[model samples]
Target: MTSHVFRVGNGHDSHRLADGGPLVLGGISVPHNRHSVGHSDADVLLHAITDAILGAAAEGDIGEWFPDTAEVNRGRCSSEMLLEVWTTIQQHGYSIVNLDCTVFAQRPKLGSHKLKIRQHIAELLKIEITQIGLKAKTGEHVGPIGHEEAIAAHCAVLLQRTDSLV
Candidate 1:
């Protein structure tokens, strides 16, 4: 068995909001008047989750793997990026134990969409929906998040080593 049986990682991401519709979060499109601005599709939730997985595996960050400077990364789908990361970690013999995620947004309440988000993430990770925990919070009109100028997300993941190696 591996020297370490478990590992934990945390990740965060944020993006400025621009006037638009169909805000994408966790691979699901939500009805909103604003969308996140970034080189990719800018799904903050997925980005954070992808980072958490990479961190847990002691792998490089998402930016290192998918640099914004590359034209191929422009408008790339966040879900596809995440899947690639997931596949890499699995190849390294890491399996997810559980994941907890939080999203901060001032507009468009996310209570109704939480289930779908969890389900989608579970599908991507090939884990049970029960293994994922998700929460939504508002900035209460205080800062960039509260002012609806940006959206942010955080994710924490527990991973287990599945291979026999040091």
Candidate 2:
């Protein structure tokens, strides 16, 4: 009988909004009045996805791998970060099965960009676009996100071991 092992991980990330920047999310540029603040490009969606992939492989998160204080990490593109982390995940003998992600924001509605975001992620992960699920939510004017002060993203990933123990 064939046996398979599956692992699941959840990751979340948030960044404060700031002026004079271009909003980058899911590796795609989104037109907005403000952008997320961070040492990297601050693509919250990609950050969450990277975290989920690392977590699934029992590896540390983005901060540990790419600290804000590191000069090499500053202003780096998040998609590149995700690719590097994905290499680690692949080396651990695991492959992503699927990923579901949600973005929390209060401005510049993301509804229209969902497909583009999903396609970008699918290309990054080398998976079918159908394997990526994207969702957007508003903060309902309750907190930092609600007040348009920040943007957040959450991602859940399922991974399976590709090698057989036999």
Candidate 3:
């Protein structure tokens, strides 16, 4: 069987630190004292992944689709945003083949928590956990992230066209 596959998109997202703000990461509310600074929930990882998918499919960027000023998105769940992205991809007759993403932060050792993040993303996209790749990195005390006052993420995605249902 021949399937069409030849597209790429990169997504990058970052957020400032909010002291005593709710720390929500990868759709999971992490136990951290500092939260992300943004109008929405400020999920750096999900934001990056969403952009990657939308970019790969040539749909559009996250901001255009989900404006921060929109009342529908005020303090909304990032997972819901991601699900909407999935819908957009499906609408374009695209399917996520695989995705690789990395999260950058200074505090909170991520080695042990990578699996949880991976599982949650897999469930959200309704794909196998193995298809989702999650990596965590520390800024090594070098930049704003190193100072533990910010977080960022990078996502690369591959999308392929499946047979049209119609």
Candidate 4:
């Protein structure tokens, strides 16, 4: 029997930097230049990951599920939001096969944190670390990200139907 092969989905997220605490990406808070200001803790990596899984399953974006309008979501951590998205995808009979993500920043040197980020995401998605591809890029001194005033991420996911695992 042919496994139900469907599609690959892409997700992108961005947030501005704020001066207060260190920044958190991919669930691990890195001591960086500035933090992200948002209604939530604003872990941009997790936000992108959540979007990828949701998109792969043809579900709506994060805002559709966790609206900024809801007072409860205010000051919420992005990891928690991501967990909810993963649950929803699984319930809909979809499991992520692999995901490739890119993080754009201008400072703090992401080289030291890539491994931790991979481990964090793998743990969150219950997937092998090999299934995740993470890349970091500098904005080349251009745009908001180049000024170290913002960070953004893009994620693409390949999800397989749960029934096909057999």
Candidate 5:
């Protein structure tokens, strides 16, 4: 009989905003004049989720797995990266119990897009939508995020061991 052990991990990511039309977040494309700038698609939400899962599993961070120095990572899709991380964690006998995420932006209010974002993330993780909780925030005209120069995201995940403990 194995006892279940729970692990909690937290991750955060931020990226500068560049003039663009579509901004990707949590695997969903949102209509926006500015988009995140990074080596990949720069989906801040997905990147944070990936890091959270990896941290819970004691795996190295996303940078170790996908480095900007590698040309192969350029323009890569963030959803694919998140899916790979989820698959790896599942193989290690870890199952996600829940995830709480937050995104901060100064423009293009996200209230209308929250549900879609959650759905896309759930689909990518192959988990029920209820397991994911997402929130959107504004920078309140303070920092880079408030100035509309950047977008940021944070994620906290709870994982449970599914394998038997000897």
Candidate 6:
């Protein structure tokens, strides 16, 4: 008999907003008055996705793979980070089943740019757009996100073993 296994992981990331006018999210730059502050591109959505994939494979989080303290990682692109994580897990015989993601920000309505962001993320993961779910929310004036002081993202991923060892 052949056995199959599934793994699920959830990840969250948040970054403080700054004076920058353009915000990068899910590999797409969206027009906004504030941007996320971080060592890298600070794409909260992509960071969360990377963590979810790594977590699902029992691998360490992004901090372990790409430490923010490293000068080499400064200004690094989040899409590239996500791609590298995906490659590592693929070599371990794991494939993404699906990913559901949410981004929280108070400004720059995401409805119009969601499809573009979803498509960009799908390309990074090498998965069909249909396999990814993207949602945007506001903090409802309750927290940093609501106050437009920060942005946050959450991601959940499902992965399955692709290689069967007989």
Candidate with the greatest TM-score versus the true structure: 1
lDDT of 6 by residue, 1-166 (tens): 1245788999999999999679999999999888899999998999999999988887999999999899989999999888988987988788888999999998889999999998998887788999999999999988889999999999999998876423
Sorted on lDDT, highest at the top, how do the candidates line up?
A: 1, 5, 6, 2, 4, 3
> What is the TM-score (0 to 1) of candidate 4?
0.94
Off by over 4 Å in 6: 1-4, 164-166
Those runs of model 4 whose alpha carbons end farther than 4 Å from true positions after fitting are: 1-3
Q: Mind giving the per-residue lDDT tens digits that candidate 4 earns over 1-166? A: 2256655888999999988668988899899758987888888888998888887777889999999999999989888899888987788788788899999999778889999999988898788999999999999999999998899999999988888777
- Candidate 3: lDDT of 91? 71
Q: Quantify how close model 3 is to the true structure by its C-alpha RMSD in Å.
A: 2.9
Q: Which ten residues in a row have the lowest lDDT in candidate 3?
A: 1-10
lDDT of 3 by residue, 1-166 (tens): 2254656778999999878855788888787779998878999999999999988877889999889889988988889999988986877677777899999998777777788888899999988998888888999998899999899999999877756423
TM-score of 5: 0.95
Give model 1's TM-score versus the native structure: 0.96
Per-prediction TM-score: 0.96, 0.94, 0.92, 0.94, 0.95, 0.95
* Local distance difference test scores for all models: 0.93, 0.90, 0.86, 0.87, 0.91, 0.90
Q: Candidate 5 residues 1-166, lDDT tens each?
A: 1254988999999999999779988888899999899999999999999999998888989999999999999999999988888898898898889999999999879999999999898888888999999999999999999999999999999998876434
Clashes of each: 0, 0, 0, 0, 1, 0
lDDT of 2 by residue, 96-142 (tens): 88999999998878989999999998888899999999999999999
Model 1 Cα lDDT, one tens digit per residue, 87-157: 98898888888999999999889999999999998988899999999999999999999999999999999
Number of colliding residue pairs in model 2: 0
Candidate 4 global CA lDDT score: 0.87
> Candidate 3 vs candidate 5: which has greater lDDT?
5
